[model samples]
Target: MTLTFDGTVLVPVADPDDGERTAAALAPLLTDRSTAVLVNVVEKAGGAPDKASVEQREEYAEEIFERARGPLEATDAAVETEIRYGTDVVDEIFAEARDRDVDAVVFTAREGSRFAELLTGSVARRLVKEAAVPVVALPHGDD
Candidate 1:
């Protein structure tokens, strides 16, 4: 059976290490026919990304996506990707999963504590609690 997953962020420093490890862990769990997606959220309009900043983000995203292509392809799984932004991250992630009718979302767990996440207002435990679909939060690490 084919399974679907939601991958968040394509930032070099924030991704690779964590996401790659999580994907590795999930590799065995998915079937050969499974289809996984690397979904990256780019704020449709985040106040402003200035020309240089926009270019920089795109460059970084390109690098991350290129690197991701290899591992996902090796799993004998089809890969899908997307980048969008205009809503709260958690809300958008859950919405995408439901819309895709995927098996679950595979994202990384915040490496910090609840208080830290709350203070940062970044995606983390809130996703697990609020996501309408099944959400798999992988620990942050390289191994």
Candidate 2:
């Protein structure tokens, strides 16, 4: 299959360093026709109140987008930043990718303990399994 990142691409930012990592990983896949959307989801509880206010979360999200957009700005890819609030992270990502007609979803692979995986679930794994679009996961070292 011919892989193309010519249309809108979704890059989900999770960790602090994930922005830089995903940017570097996506460079080769992108072309002048590519438009990348840097996304960060703020996981809200089902019924419990959030520790931080919406404005606070939005402010933080903007900072993340700024950092993530830096590398893409230098390239030919058009860059857009977004903040989403949701209870299910995977669903939010898939929804954005489908709604935007994303050509690919790029993210960094995170290694977590079994307990952690059981509790929060693996976003990368779930996305790869459920996402209709291509999911590119860049392997990460233990840091």
Candidate 3:
């Protein structure tokens, strides 16, 4: 199916750099009527000690959103930020996508070695394979 940027989109960002790169890649595609929802999934450790405090993660999420906002803001697309919490990152993204009824889920894939991806279970692969909405994988800045 053809992808259009007139409707709302769910954008999952990993970190500040990822956020900036993803937004840069996606910015050119967005229209004046588009709404870009920047989301950072704070993965919760179920029944285990947390790696970071919730406040720390939320602050980091805000930092991500701030970096991501600039590129999209240069365009006419409306930018919004959401900090999501869940044990499963991909699942949380999908849930937010469904909840928002977004036209698409847009992101730039994070770089990693094949072995690293295997060990970490690539979120990019899971997002494309299991997405309920249209999933757009934009090229990274170097690409």
Best by lDDT: 3
lDDT tens digits, residues 55-118, model 2? 9888888777777776676788788887888999999998889888887888877667989989
**Of models 1 and 2, which has the larger TM-score?**
2
> In model 2, what are the clashing residue pairs, if there are any?
none
User: What is the C-alpha lDDT profile of model 3 across 94-139, one tens digit per residue?
Assistant: 9999999999999899889999998989999999999899998987
* CA lDDT of each prediction against the hidden true structure: 0.58, 0.81, 0.93
The model with the greater TM-score, 2 or 3, is 3
Best by TM-score: 3
User: Candidate 1 has what TM-score?
Assistant: 0.71
RMSD in angstroms between candidate 3 and the native structure over all alpha carbons: 1.6
* Structural RMSD, model 1: 4.8
Colliding pairs, model 3? none
46: Cα error in model 1, Å: 4.8
Error of 1 at 76 (Å): 1.2
